[model samples]
Target: MFQTDSENDSAEPHYLRLRNQIANEIEAGILSSGARLPSERKYHELIGSARGTVREALSQLEAEGLIYRKDRSGWYVSPKPVTYDPTRWSGFMTYVAEQGRLPATETLQVKTEKQPPAILDIFGKGVRNPLYRVERRRSIDERPVLVEDITINPALAPGLARHNLNGSLSGVLRDVYGLVVTRNHVEMRACALVRHTAECLGVKSGTPGLLVIRTSYDARGRVIEYDQEYWCANAIRIEVDLTVA
Candidate 1:
């Protein structure tokens, strides 16, 4: 591992030193997601600091969702940070392309996995029952921007493979399936990027990332699509448009 500044030997709290060093590594992309940090003792020796100091720093980082401890394992870097916009009703590809970057999808994994238990519990269905899933790394101006895992009603849009994914799913839903999207119900929260997300987005595990839960509705107010997008912090920003009545 490429080590940076070690903790100062002064009586300053040891955890602060650890926090500063780890934070620096994350911002620099040196200690990316899934990057395992040295053990507490290792950190102590590496920084010529006390074990308690290293422990304190690790604790704070974990609490902030910057690092996590594994069973029989150690701490690791989180994935890319995520940014979300609660104001925009447009879909992911549409919102991103409007920013002037061409949209693309690599289709890393698209088969189907059991819907997360919480999701299944809420929807009360097979959960994974025939969801049209498409996972991709979203980018802007050729710079990595976000990773999107979108799931839609396969019954609504049966022939997903025939659609041109380079553009927006909403467009396809409108033009091909004739299911016009008019609105969406959305929510936002803070979370840490786990192993998979961290590896793909090039951040660390337990790193702070945005969590978006949205249900897109069509002209008939029917929930046709649901999506989760893990966006890098600096990749994009959302601004609300206002009008004076």
Candidate 2:
């Protein structure tokens, strides 16, 4: 059931009343996580408000991290954020599972291509050197949350093209290629999701998103892998533990 702005809610913005009502329901578990909300028209009709007012209220909730919009799909109550620690050398499956969530990965593309100019500069490789590139979409609890494009130095992981990439690449590198990510350099920023990446992650293009670029090094300090990951802005909670020397 929805409520209209009564005497108690008279002083506040109409949308805020709706936003608060929805948020209260979510916090009280009336609207469970991953639950789809009513369509804009339905919501507005229920509340006896304009569609624009309903939309504004939903936008406020989204900005508060209580809900999210899926491209071509209706809004949903955001699931618990997956905590990510960039300093840890861990696999996607590992962290997701640790949080009691199901993790799935879909391989989007695999190819051997001439080293990209940026990759070449990082790897210090010849222009002719071919790198193995893999693009993947990863999901938690059936919601696509990340799209990652990764380039691997073929010289470091021979026969990598033959492995099943739908699983953890970190696992494959460790078990098959005998390579370990001893150290890594990670950079993160807020960005507008590109069309292709947004589509892959099931979000609207130009949505504010999180970008993480990581370069992994082997024990010998060789650049083993470079990857860029695009994430749904509300789908993850980045947490890092630090100790001062």
Candidate 3:
């Protein structure tokens, strides 16, 4: 029943402007899961547009899985994207909690190690960093969300498990290792889940997931963690939120 159009960007066409306005509300978490969207008549009033224009916007949203319309009951908001908040300092647990979902971790392996060459390139340095291999699966409300293989330089966080592998690595590094993360570089691409990865993540080998390659550095600009996260493809739509100074 609320207005959708804004005077901020008046140059755009009325229907397109309305569509974007409604879409942003869905993305921002203000309009929550299962909340029925206003009727066409209501949206027409809200956007100061024609009924046909409002219907076009609604149709687009429905096609994109952002909302759905019942035969007679009208439109309702889609579920929130599987929450993967970039603003958070913590990992899956903190993010899940913020979204009101319970989180659990499956720790498959944690072992001291030397640097791996492929990972060395990711860190952009020599492979002599003295590292450990940490493999785990993170789940949201008992549903698998991510499978992570982290190569952490022991020099950064001595006896990393002494802090906690089940929760925030960023916090542990800062609290125990006295290191602050100043940089993070992420690269995402699509790949088929391998048998090993899929088995750990409860998906099939052919299942598509996002392979996220990441390098994290301390405030001193030292590479600390070189990791790959296999996120369930259906779990989230990662977006960059940026602002100009």
Candidate 4:
């Protein structure tokens, strides 16, 4: 059984004391990343607190990005976040490998979709274009990180649907269609994961996450692709380097 410091016993809530203890152990590397934690029942027994108190402490740790709960699997220490540079054109696989982490992608669904009104606005009003919709989930070190829904202008890359999408679509565009991304417009916002995406990432629905919307354009300024990505909040860190004029 664990005991709180006598000085803290009177000053802090039981759950806060538990949270601080675990957080300190994690920061001190006593609890290594990816290590599964003791069950709530076990923790409460060890700490001499209610199971609900232990659960609340775990929830706090998760919100602070120090831990995660894998459905059916118990809590685990969160891995160090992957740094992502929104300004860089380097693809996901390349960057992830550069950081000495394994990157993986799974193509979930691929279909030819009629231009929805929002899509038509981007492709051009009243343009009857065939858009390819692709759904994918990406992981690092076998832990699911993000899910993306992509819209591709098949007219820009003929036979795009025929190609395997389990890899980088940017590579497919460059190698197969001879098109390279020259410009991108990116927007980010905090969101709650919807049901489908939440399931894909192995998180509960309505879990807090980050949404990244990207529209890629070629040198001639045509919108080739638009994708929306829902990222596990603790799994990634955004970094951008800029040059001063």
- How much does each candidate deviate from the true structure in C-alpha RMSD? 7.8, 3.3, 7.9, 3.0
Model 2, position 190, has a per-residue lDDT of 89
Worst 10 residues of 1 by lDDT: 1-10
Best by TM-score: 4
Clashes of 2: 0
Off by over 4 Å in 4: 1-3, 9-14, 39-53, 70-74, 125-127, 241-245
Clashes of 1: 12
Model 4 lDDT-worst window of ten: 1-10
Q: How close is candidate 3 to the true structure, as a TM-score?
A: 0.62
Which tens-of-lDDT digit does each residue in 96-169 have in candidate 3?
Answer: 68778777877778888766577667666544655788888888767677899988877666688655677766
Provide TM-scores for the models: 0.57, 0.81, 0.62, 0.83
Look at candidate 3 and give me any clashing residue pairs. none
Q: Which stretches of candidate 1 lie over 4 Å from their true place?
A: 1-85, 90-104, 112-128, 241-245
Off by over 4 Å in 3: 1-80, 85-90, 124-130, 242-245
* Number of colliding residue pairs in each model: 12, 0, 0, 0
What's the best-to-worst order under TM-score? 4, 2, 3, 1
lDDT of 3 at 166: 75
Select the stronger candidate by lDDT from 1 and 3. 3
